[model samples]
Target: MTVGLVVVSHSAQLAAGVVELASQMAHDVALVAAGGMDDGSVGTSLDRIMAALDEADSGDGVVVLADLGSAVMTAEAAIEFLDRPAAACLADAPLVEGSVAAAVEAQGGADQAAVLHAAETAWSPAGSASPPGPSGPKAGGGAPAPLTSVFTLVNPLGLHARPAAALASELGALDVEIDVNGVDAQSVMMLMTLGAGQGAELHVSASGPEAQQALDVVRRAVESGFGES
Candidate 1:
């Protein structure tokens, strides 16, 4: 019976992606985010997240999860500034892991400890993520493929809603393992948060029975400027 959860990350897309994934698997953990903004403003993310926290009525006190160290400080300051009634605890894992842990714990009536383990479990075999290669996983795999293809925010809009929506729609149908750099590229806000534009690149790769097909699909979308067509 803990309170709701806040997932803090340097990238909003990553944070959002984790929440989305968590919602499907674990339903108890509510998520808010303190994510990056395009203006290079970090504080605003916290403000936005706290606002979300305000709406939740879970009396058990909230736990705050952070991706990196800075996320910790920011989360602390955010809780302090609001004087929120929920007891905010910071977990040192990426948003995906923290969100998973928080969700499981919140629903199971456990502490944040369980949440941390979920993170560790979430990222494995590939050292938790797709570094320069792909950020997701490999299905029907013999071995992980060589890293190939990347998506940069070279466009002025940095993969905004329209582009992201297009990208999602195009990529969604494919049987591919898509991993977004810095959190989750699968998320629109997270993509928005990348603050990538007019030259930023995001790594995308697929390795599995359908890796080639997935790669082609993503490649076309990226070259098409996030499927602006």
Candidate 2:
């Protein structure tokens, strides 16, 4: 089984909506929503969060994303109360974007830590504050030159959420640094920030031992129109 996700928010409708949107791309992932109080008021509920966490955890572990203020606190309390506290953790990320990224990564079969990284980095442009330089040691112990390529998006919707999530989630698992149109290819939010539409060129660059493989993956996704018309 893959990692699971829990979304905690003040509004029940908001939490359910986020789950609905994320489920589009990660249908197999357990995305539970814990929003509002038992009375359906606009507030956080520890009991609700705890119950949702239990529902989400499927032995692979669970990642929790919460909205501002008490929602976070409630989620933390729920996690702390878990029978296996270490089996779950909270992601310090935007409620919606982080949940989507986390869900995608989890659906891609990423471990809990990697899934957490995907969520926490959802709002960032690159993996780290500074751009990742070339990776992989060369034959002479030198850093390999970054590989670059360009692929035109042929999908009717181009680099939309589903495609972006697929690319970012898959690419994030590789031991390489990739940039698409100047945005980190491993960040779903960053890729969506490109606003690349149909027929737009995706300027891609990568480094590390898996650089070529990463480029090939992008090529396949774009050239195939991401399996769409």
Candidate 3:
């Protein structure tokens, strides 16, 4: 089962717009927009957030990304009102970036924890070191090199949201630890952090049972220009 996402904002247009943008790369993922009050004014509403949480969940769980302080507070209230609070949680992340990242992760079949982690890390400083290795370094030496390859981004926009989401959604489901230029391949935010404009070479590597497949997926997406001309 795949996790879902809810975008909450004071402006109904903003929330819906975010959902629309995120859905471009994650068409199969469930995303709900809860914004504005019943009268369509700029304000948060517990009822709307609760309704979004319900519509967004597909049994696996749901991750809520809210804009501004009141939006977050409203989301929290909605989560608390749920009979099963653990089934949903609020992510403290920037609205657009977090929603897009979370949507991609959810589309990739990540669980609640992984989806939340994706949103939380959306704002991490660019070029930060890779996340901790799955296991500590081996006593004898460093871990074995993963299946690796290099591909230059040919699209003028480089690795923008759509391409990043496409790569992350396709790769995140694989049973592999893949990194593109030292950032997690399954993370849309990390991929965007590269700011890899045209001709920027992406160092793709993977380690796990599906390493080859994961690497191929990224290679193919990059070669295809991620559907861009």
* TM-score versus the correct structure, for each prediction: 0.43, 0.91, 0.85
lDDT (0-100) at residue 60 of candidate 2?
Answer: 93
Q: What is every candidate's alpha-carbon RMSD to the true fold? A: 11.0, 2.4, 2.8
Indicate whether candidate 1 or candidate 3 has the larger TM-score. Answer: 3
Task: Estimate, for each residue in 1-229, the C-alpha lDDT of model 1 and write its tens digit.
Answer: 4556776677777667766765653455566655666465543365655665664326666666677767667677777776653355555555654465346445555555444444433433332433444433433345666445775544456666456534543444555555556444333334445555667777765544566765676567666666443
Per-residue lDDT of 36-91 in model 2, one digit per residue for the tens? 88997899998899889889988999999999999988888888898889899999
* Local accuracy by lDDT, each model: 0.55, 0.88, 0.85
What tens digits encode model 3's per-residue C-alpha lDDT throughout 78-192? 9999999998999988998888888887887778998898888787753242365544453236656678899998878889877887777788678788888887777788888
Judged by TM-score, which candidate is best?
2
Q: What is the lDDT, from 0 to 100, of the residue 138 in candidate 3?
A: 35
After superposition, candidate 1 runs with Cα above 4 Å error: 38-44, 84-86, 111-229
Model 3 worst lDDT run, 10 consecutive residues = 126-135
Candidate 2: worst-modelled 10 consecutive residues by lDDT: 130-139
TM-score of 2: 0.91
